[model samples]
Target: MKLQSTPPIPASDRQSPPAVLTLGPASCDAAILAQLLPVAERFRLNSAHLDPGGLVGWLDRLEALFEAEGRSVPVVVDLQGAKMRIGRFPSIPRLPGRVELVPGDRSERADTIPVPHPGLFRHAAPGDRLFLNDARVELEIERVGDERIGARTVRNGPLEASKGINRAPHPLPFEALSDRDASMIDASIGRPFVEYALSFVRSAQDAGLLRPRLGGHRLIAKLERTEAIAHVREIDAAFDESWLCRGDLGAQAGVGELGPIQRRIATLIPSLRNPCYLAGQVLEHMTHFPEPTRSEVVHLYEVARSGFAGVVLSDETAIGRHVAEVAGFLARAAPEE
Candidate 1:
């Protein structure tokens, strides 16, 4: 297969912080990618969200587009790690008004939803909370049954298929990488992929466990949990790079400490010679607005001052009204002029 062309790196980009633009959530779609890539070509957000299952199709299409346009970009595959996801249930006439958590990896029945791991059963109890899809949907367990747990929703919104599930920050006796993540890495054995975004890294063990799977690929240890923060130095040493993913980190570090902790982590990585990326909520307001908020402007300056090698966007580029505009502002902030 023909590799996409590697464009000359301008002196400006060499001196500026690199930005990686993400494809839209359903960005896997060929048409959506068609719309997004032209913008990516212009702004040069080299790194993109590459996951396992959809890797080949996206690469084929991306290669065609970039080859046609005469460009190439780095691919970063983000591993889901041991983060828990609500299991699949067949669609009912309507989802139960009551939320349910049943055991197993999948379900096709009514009312009872699948929670997959039996280990979670030990931690959960009545009146405890369950956060689904990054807290977009909340389930407060009213009662726990022998077979299933039932709850009522506190926050209701659009829920994605395979949304993540979590309670509070408690240490699970498991490695950060999930079986699924390992299989994914194994599948990508010979692809010239650039990096692995190892998720849920909580300790040096978490980082070390994944380093071998990467097969010498760049490792971006995502510091999302407080445990990762507590042991940042070792985790930093174990990986080639680090990322401060504020969304999940907020859950692990307490929302109050997300900002301070993000700054602190960003400050630490540069001294270790491990470049860090500031991800999440960088241009969140731009998803709706024509212009960036004053705070967003300040946030960019904070990123640069703290020595982040790059900034990452999720909604701002993926689902934002102005994907290219958001990319432009980010480029301006850390100009590749």
Candidate 2:
């Protein structure tokens, strides 16, 4: 199915706005809740790095926090689906030079490395590309051997392990949930007030697997990969809601291409009638500094003007020290009559 345009934000509802914020387990503390929940429309708990036990507690705190304020906020639990990524090293030095990917290197200190994901080796071939650290750097598969795959930097940057890795040119043949993600999903079952965000949905098949796991709750497919873009219509047909994850998207398609992709996704996902959010780096400064950048503010307005349903503040709210300030900024910056 072709994508459709988002309905205009109702003039009446424009007077009040909805902005979504993602909170990490650490950020779910009562202090942060006291300042954030009243203004946020939704809270996304990212399950990528969080342990199962920690996530449960985060959910509990989220409920109590909202209740204390005499309001109920929607909770989105983002499952770390079948996306391929490198595990973290003890301390990844900020290498000034490019780190090559070599086969059979098990030691932690090797300049070239072997990722723990055996599936990556099985699927990646020469000429394919891999995205690292939100696409800040690119690694090209130079060779595919019996035991491993070799890659070289196409774009130069310092990379640490545990930064996300994605294959390019073709989608990998595998389930969306890694073993760790499966564990997280199992732990999250039967949780109240939690919606599931399925990441890297490339086709209807991906959505099909996710639907059964969702246990009758809402599932929002996060469309980020090029394959997902190509098969968006099918994925949209399979799921009720979608989020255009523009951060990893910019990495896959370059920053310049993001706008058109966003427009296209907004058009295709009929259920996503709100502003297909232009997420990632919207308030990156707030992650370290207490204030948002002027450019970030402009981008936020751009997203609002485009009529996005909501914007997600990931690292800005999750790990950042300025969670409350970022939440407040989005609440105030949102379009209000």
Candidate 3:
């Protein structure tokens, strides 16, 4: 769907840091959508969750609503960007034992795990470590085969299906833009208010692979990999904006190292080519409950006071039960400007 020409924002409101809210299946509710729109300066759609058609439907409604008010909120489509993930199978109750990683999106046996990407099978080796479900579970590869790899859990925990997969020290070899990402990008073309974000950016070169396909939309680089942080200056020059995705970064960098990594990014904020936004787990407590923890509230305030241009809420606003309360709290806590 083509967007109508957007109305101008009042100059007085431009200086304040913009709150970018991500939309999920839950946001399809009209009342919930209404509650969310007012508090957010921008909206984000995850291509992994919402298909191209759904994205268009969302933009149609959002654009119409904002146009009626003589204003517009920018829309960002966050591409999956080769994020490796395990496929469907029964949730593992005992994850410590031997498991076989097989091809495709499903496994018939409980002891077997399914991973859809061929790069995993080709690149995996003995003794390699794999982090699953945001690093909640860890696996050590014991054998590699043409069809699958044998692994044993290093960190034992219950595992669910369709969770994120990562290999440290040696990342998987997935393309920078998946076919789904390309399709979503095509869906977003011709809409002036629409922008695109590349996830799991490892370096300026990774951003280079995606920039040409964005059709002139502003590209935001999600600095989730340690490699990306190491080459932040090059990335700063390549992308229009940057986002510090703490959740993934923590998983990749280890929780103990995340703070230092963030401080490193914080130190380089002045040298960055464009605005860098903070993302992931900002209002995590509010995801399952009504109120954010005191620390979370303080964290939001501190992030605003820090050099970040804005913040992005992941599960907090996407699937949280207390959407209105979360939005209100952010508005009260940060009070943009």
Candidate 4:
């Protein structure tokens, strides 16, 4: 009945390269890596979560511990590039009527929530589903205009402010790098494994822009956008590895495309032999639940079976309650060695 435990990983499997399990930035315990040094494949730090000083401290500690323990994992910093987010809105625990999803600024009216970016409206149309923050709060776009977007909640739940907004894949165009991303990359220079992972990469050109910022460190092209997948080979060539950030992909990809897309990318990475990892909503419910759902287990197994180098956990470890347990599942859950 234990959801966390799968069949034991065969001895041969344990000897193989451990699946690269990535923990998110919210996992500031810093020492968690040392504790699970053998389990983790990489640690992901977000720019918004820590300043330059804090990052250096954690990196130093983990690297030093690895040296002493003869164990180490790469630390990947997400530039948050091309991650479109909505502006601040009140915690609408329940539904609000006729909310004006405004653009360019926050709204004074309680009924309004601005999405500073104008591009969201450009590609989105009436009836397109919008997922805010998480899948909990879904909106069906009823109106898209020059000034505001109006959507009625499809799945009523609490809505948080300043979280990412994901719409159906509809040519949602934008630059890959922000000025802030450049600054973080500049600040992260010289740190071990301060390697840059560009999110929502659309094309090889987008991935190419990050090389200068990477300072010759590894470049991980995260394929989430539908556009990016279209140019998968070019982007794959432009970077050292590929990343399947499925949570965003689910939100951005058409519902039907999700399955085929996952299969294609999962199939594509192994052939490239570029140390790819699968992430997003992998263990979403395991944060509080004692065991993961049936679907979650199958998904993790699929990741392991894909013959990729690793799989990643975002919220599962970042803000989730059961970080270690989930990592234990991935670290230990392998097929035959």
Q: lDDT of all predictions, in order shown? A: 0.66, 0.70, 0.79, 0.69
- Tell me the tens digit of each residue's lDDT in model 3 across 1-337: 9989988754443333567998876566767777777778798887766678987887888778777666678889888786777777688666748888988887767778898877788778899989887788889999998797999978877777767788886575435567778888888877899988887887777777876787678998898877888888898898899999987777788899988887778888977779999987888898889898989766766766567888898777777777878777755654345
Task: Estimate TM-scores for all models.
Answer: 0.78, 0.83, 0.88, 0.80
Q: Clashing residue pairs, candidate 2?
A: 3-267, 3-268, 4-267, 81-176, 82-176, 82-177, 274-309, 275-307, 275-308, 275-309
Report the poorest 10 consecutive residues by lDDT, candidate 3: 9-18
Residue-wise C-alpha lDDT for candidate 4, range 66-117, written one tens digit per residue: 7888766677887767776666667667667556687764555566777766
Q: Which sections of candidate 1 miss by over 4 Å? A: 1-16, 25-53, 88-98, 104-112, 122-128, 141-147, 152-158, 171-173, 331-337
Clashes (candidate 4): 3
Give the candidates in order of lDDT, highest first. 3, 2, 4, 1
Ordered from best to worst TM-score, the candidate numbers read 3, 2, 4, 1
Clashes of each: 0, 10, 0, 3
TM-score of 2: 0.83
Over 1-337, each residue of candidate 1 has an lDDT whose tens digit, in order, gives: 9999999866554343456666655355555555555344221111223345566555566667667756666666677665677677564433456877888867766566787667678767887777766666667788877877888878665554466677765534444556666766775656674466776777777767776677787777877777778888887778887878888777655678876887677667656767778888887898988689998777676676677877776777766787656655654554343
- Measured with C-alpha atoms, the lDDT of residue 184 in candidate 4 is 76
Superposed model 4: Cα runs more than 4 Å off: 1-9, 13-26, 48-70, 103-110, 121-129, 140-147, 293-298, 330-337
lDDT tens readout by residue for model 2, 1-337: 9999999866544432356678874476788777787677788887866778987888777667767778887788887666655665434534324455544324476455556666776777788988877877777777888765666777765566556778875656546567667777777777767778877777778777766667788777787777778876666667766677887777777789887887876565454432244467767899988788888766665566565666677888888978877767756654554
lDDT of 3 at 133: 75
